[model samples]
Target: MCGMLGGLLLSAVLIEGKIYFSETFGEGWQQRWRLSTWKEGHAEKMGKWQTSAGKWYRDEVEDAGLQTAEIMKFYAISASFEPFSNEGKELIVQYQAKYEKDLACGGGYLKLGPSTEDLSKFGDSTKYNIMFGPDQCNAEKRTHLIFRYGGRNFLKKAELPYKQEGEGLSHLYTLHLKPDNTVRVLVDLDKIYEGSLKDDWEMLPPREIADPKDQKPSDWLDEEMMEDPADVKPPDWVESKMMVDPKAGKPEEWDDEEDGEWDAPKIENPNFKGPWLPRKIPNPDYKGTWKARIVPNPDFSDDPDLYKYSDIGYVGFDVWQVKGGTIFDNIIITDSLKEAEDMAQKWKALREVEDAAKKNEDEAQAKAFEKAKAARAARSKENKAGDTKNEKKDEL
Candidate 1:
């Protein structure tokens, strides 16, 4: 009986440890993902998702995924799958995004939720278990990491680090949720944030709070310093900050109507001592700042499994962009961090090659543009000289 039980437990562990879903958006990706629509009566505008090398490419066209149409339009899309439970396991979500147009304002993020029935209705009101990615609008550019708690969505209390500007390069964002109720956020495979879920997220009210009935005593001397009674103002101190020059007088030949009325110019008084104040000295009765006593919060409750989500059935992007040319590809969701990291490494290698190709192409284009500009300038100069010579001949 013991041997049979061990075998069954091992099987369950293996099943939970494997990759739940992974998509590179290679050939026939349309079968796996669905594009959402915005409807007005009979008119429906489905979000444009077409394959591209994403502003940079190697010789291989297979290394592309569906990119945003990049126009004055709204977008909402999702790809659903079988419901996967993250309970008692590490949930890893990873993906790559490229802002080819150096997106000035847009959301390049993904949402994971349980519902898949009405992806077209996905909007700001849609609830999600997790929302992670870079978002920028005007001066505010940051990675958004929001989690739903007790039927309400709560954003991370700490500011998520993200780059507002882009260099037309692809970046990978990864989120690792460990079974121990801890989370780690990474950008480009580098860990940017790591902490317990309870500390970083306000999932619950604080365990303790300042006692309401307790207050600082009115007679408590919190000030560290006081004015020195011994210090006094000097006898020669000038009261006025500025004074009229006694040696100067009105011009003798001045006419009131023709010339402006002559007046002695007021200058800063050298003898002036700005305000009179005694020097500060250490206060004898000084007391430290009073802090209210803390007690257990009445409403505080503990939940060790706050990081666990029951079901995550779909991954989607619902974003608005001013000038969208963002490409999202190589999405992976698994229970193993090692699997996610390995996937990121594979994508990183491809990005290096594509980036190099883009650099070379840019240089070649710049040189060609400069050569054309020079030729145009030379022709213009020759025409001007010929016109000048014809003008001189006409004068002759």
Candidate 2:
């Protein structure tokens, strides 16, 4: 009995230890990414890494622009496992991350596996994202949450301040996977924005394969993974059909002309004022008083004036940190999209007013120029007349 039990335990351990794929920043492996490069079209920079005590470490820095709340977040991320293994089992994963002290406008996270489909019921759902950044200020100075779901992708999501009293560091996020394929995320460090859906969470079922028995294929596996033998009897018409050739690349007689290729238009950041930071979502269901905290970055000696309008073309900065303060925890549950639109509309109106003022100034300048030209013409005419009269008098 003891021998049998030991053998069973060994089998279980072997199965558990089997890794489909993995790449830790171990001895020789080095993977680093800049926190700033997450901007839509920010160009990627060369990565830097060092070896210490037989271990390898890489650091990624992003030039996320010079504006405050322009969160520059990067992660040394990796993904492994046989995606097409046809196994219907879900995975539970965990990892550790560390952030530098006074690392204003930054945070890190470990992302798990992702599906390649639009999981959000709304046709516009993203697949993966991670959050990071400084945790200060209310509704303005914010940390970051980055995600890429559906086809559209965005970076540096602004975090709302929900903490009130003490200073805290180090965050742990856990994912709970249910047998029903539902996944939930829990943030351990700060409970500001909790229980938010990271993606559409694709939970739809497949429709291809029919039954597992009678030579029928499983729905989990793709068509190309199925195999058939020529000599053997062709099974039922449904299951006997030859599967797509997985080894095939592009068709041999492919014609580029038939399918014209066009480059996607690249988007660049507008040369606008500083504080071009992400939008913040405010909680509206608060019951008591709330305070805003000013998160300081000691490394930066430049006064907040650097981001003032006189310096960057606009008056007030887009995102600003609190000099010294803290916000007490208050439950304000509300939607963010509506709030962001309201804020944007206000900005739009202000811009319109500025534009109208500028137009009026231009018109006034033009009118003055016209008046000066008219006066000069009248003077010239009078001088010419006087000279004609004098000539006439001399002739007489």
User: Who wins the lDDT comparison?
Assistant: 1
How far is 171's C-alpha from truth in model 2 (Å)?
4.4
Model 2: lowest-lDDT 10 consecutive positions: 308-317
* Residue 139 displacement in candidate 1 (angstroms): 4.6
Task: Count clashing pairs, candidate 2.
Answer: 17
Off by over 4 Å in 1: 1-16, 38-47, 163-166, 229-279, 337-342, 361-396
Query: Across residues 1-396, which tens digit of lDDT does each residue of candidate 1 receive?
Result: 213212221222433366878888787788877766544352334456677766565434656866887564567778888888888887889898888776667889999988567776665667789999999887788999888878888888987988534556778888887777888787776667878878988898999999999989989999999998888878876778899988778888988889877778898888887887779999999988888999999999999888888888888888887788888888998886556666776567767876687788889999999999999999999999999999999999
Predicted candidate 2 versus true structure: per-residue lDDT over 36-130, tens digit per residue: 22223433321112322111112111101111122232222232223422123222222222222233432232333243221111111223332
Top TM-score hit: 1
RMSD of each: 8.4, 31.1
Clashes of each: 0, 17
